[model samples]
Target chain A: MAKAVAPRGFARERVLEAALALFAEHGVNGTSLQMIADRLGVSKAAVYYQFHSKEEIVLAVIQPVFDDMARLVRIAEAMSTPEAQQEVAVNGMVDFTVRHRRVTAVFHGDPAIDTLVNSRADLSDIIERLTVMLLGTDPDVTTRIVISVLASGMYGSATDPKLSDIDDGDLHQVLLDCCQRLMRTRGAIGDLRTRGAIGI
Target chain B: MAKAVAPRGFARERVLEAALALFAEHGVNGTSLQMIADRLGVSKAAVYYQFHSKEEIVLAVIQPVFDDMARLVRIAEAMSTPEAQQEVAVNGMVDFTVRHRRVTAVFHGDPAIDTLVNSRADLSDIIERLTVMLLGTDPDVTTRIVISVLASGMYGSATDPKLSDIDDGDLHQVLLDCCQRLMRTRGAIGDLRTRGAIGI
Candidate 1:
């Protein structure tokens, strides 16, 4: 994103909002800068003045999420117990995914991580930190697979044919239930749920 | 597939194998008939002579999996208990997925499922039947999400960056363990595992 002497937050928000809508409909790769400009009823130069490239627009749109996770990582790291850290990590991921369910579905449902966002080591590093906080370091092969499936499924669930129709709050609970089941860690909240419990 | 009077299975196999290889590298949509011919070291005419279109080639390539599931569905339907049927379904999927891990990755890993194979009712029907077998009738929303995550994860795990490197046997066991855990069903094998047990 280009920074102006007086950053027009209003113009930037419009561009980002228009770009997100277009991305949701046509996918990140399919949406063009021209289309975004057209959607905004603005000239290409006007949009260009805000964002140099389409990727920058996407980055700016998703920048809040990166910031959110960075803050979460800090909070989780400050905690002492693995269980507490994991709760924070898992809770943050589930809440964010649920809060922005539609957006997450659009981006992840795209076949390949478009070269648009591909090879971003910083994003991956944050995700990795959150993952370790959730599963702890040096987890066994089973834990890796379990968490991998849950993570993959959680992202895809928003766009899933059957799950899509369900309410977001219900979706969040079930996903957390799944994560807890697969991880099989009782932790402090184990008192609330019966052992081996599977419910909505 | 063209019904050659001779029904030359040998030539057909060569075409299908070449098409599969091309599809793996360049997704179903990216792989053209000509590319498959080039891979097979045959003329495009030869490839067209074997299958009427690229979709036909993909259909032929995945035909065996459909047949395998159909047969599995029959066996599971005959089982008396839901648990028995679920085991039959789960075991069949795991074994088939592990047995054909590379192919599964190539096809399922492709986004949009390729218009090459999209909107195929017969494939969806078979998958639905298999899902019903595994999930039983009228499962709760929680069960649906848990199984949804597991099933989605199972298909995608073959190509998942972290899980991809795992040995097939270990992957199979862990996936089954995850499924059984989320299902929370002791079934006939509860005795085999300790209560609420999760292991690789």
Candidate 2:
């Protein structure tokens, strides 16, 4: 079955994209292998040829987004100043989230997917590093809590109908503004600039 | 089956509490009427006596939270001043969310629940009223957008494990501070305070 599968270099990517759309509409549990296969106009065996199981397909879909998030955090970590790192990381994360809002929603809104995200040590590790980077040194318990809340807000808020019309660019700016206010301290603006991000 | 139910008051509350716990752990799809009954140490017949179906149980659990949030917004709407109302509304919401995070989590996390929440006009009306109250009259797109982001942040931020340890009092303060930063303009703030909330 594997040998007979299409040789397209982007087979995995194609499957993931299709899976995300179907997962979003019908949910991870509500969706099935056959539905995804039908959506792709491929047979069940073709779908199976690409992915070993639904779990593997789901992980494949979620991995790219988390990988993108992890990459942004890594870049922000490379920045010399804490403030700049925070700004760039915050903006990058928000923008990435907006870009992949539906995928993120499918992940967040589905308990099975959520369980998978939380249970995967690799994913959790990436999230932990991002949290540490965001929290910085000497973060009080309160700041830790606020940052956590802000992250969820970014993910969950995008799906809210009241906020539906607000486009990505504006949401990015608004989130940055909120983050700045939450983390504001003396020299914060200068620190942000040093990392190549400007604060208005 | 319908005739075997308990008094409407006790049966409704008992069924809701059991359903919420089960839903939180097993998810809506993972959970069943039998499971809820077992968890509550009751018979399947007893469960059916209380709730006709899983949908009814879910509706019973979700609507109350929406109603409570609506009540909060209504109280905020009655205030003559934005400062007082903002302070009260923000604190109330944070407290409400923290106290009922599990229910909120189920409400936010489950796609089935979210779909149901979206389709329920009664619930949507309350949420819309709350959003409009936050946005105020003549709200420019920016104010509306920021409020929407903040609202999303509020619910999203609550369940994050990173923010899990934050004490309720501290979280409440942080949310209030974030709210102030989000509603930055005087005219917007003024309109938000003066804007009348429509009753459902």
What TM-scores result for chain A when each predicted structure is judged separately against the true chain A?
A: 0.78, 0.75
lDDT for residue B47 in candidate 1, whole number 0-100 = 81
User: lDDT per residue, candidate 2, A1-200, as tens digits?
Assistant: 66655465377777888998898788888889999899989898988888989999999888778889889888988999987877777777777888876677787657678788788999888877777678787776556655665676677666656667766655555566656655553223343334333322
Highest lDDT model number: 1
lDDT, candidate 1, A1-200, per-residue tens: 56653368888989988988898878887899999999989899999888999878888877777778888999999999987997778778877878777667666746534444446888878877887897788765666777777777677665576777777766776777667676672221243233225532
For model 1 the local lDDT of residue B178 reads: 70
**How far out, in Å, is residue A61 in model 2?**
3.3
As a whole number from 0 to 100, the lDDT of residue B138 in candidate 1 is: 81
- What candidate 2 gets wrong by more than 4 Å, as runs, is A1-7, A10-13, A48-52, A79-85, A115-122, A137-139, A159-166, A185-200, B1-16, B45-67, B79-92, B112-122, B137-140, B161-164, B185-200
- Identify the leading candidate in terms of DockQ: 2
- Residue-level lDDT for A161 in candidate 2: 61
Model 2 per-residue lDDT tens digits across residues B1-200? 55555466777788788888888787797899989889888899988877789998898787667777888988988988866666667666777887777788777656688788788898877767766566565675556656666667777767665566765655555666665655563334344334323311
TM-score of chain B as predicted in candidate 2: 0.72
Each candidate: what lDDT? 0.74, 0.72
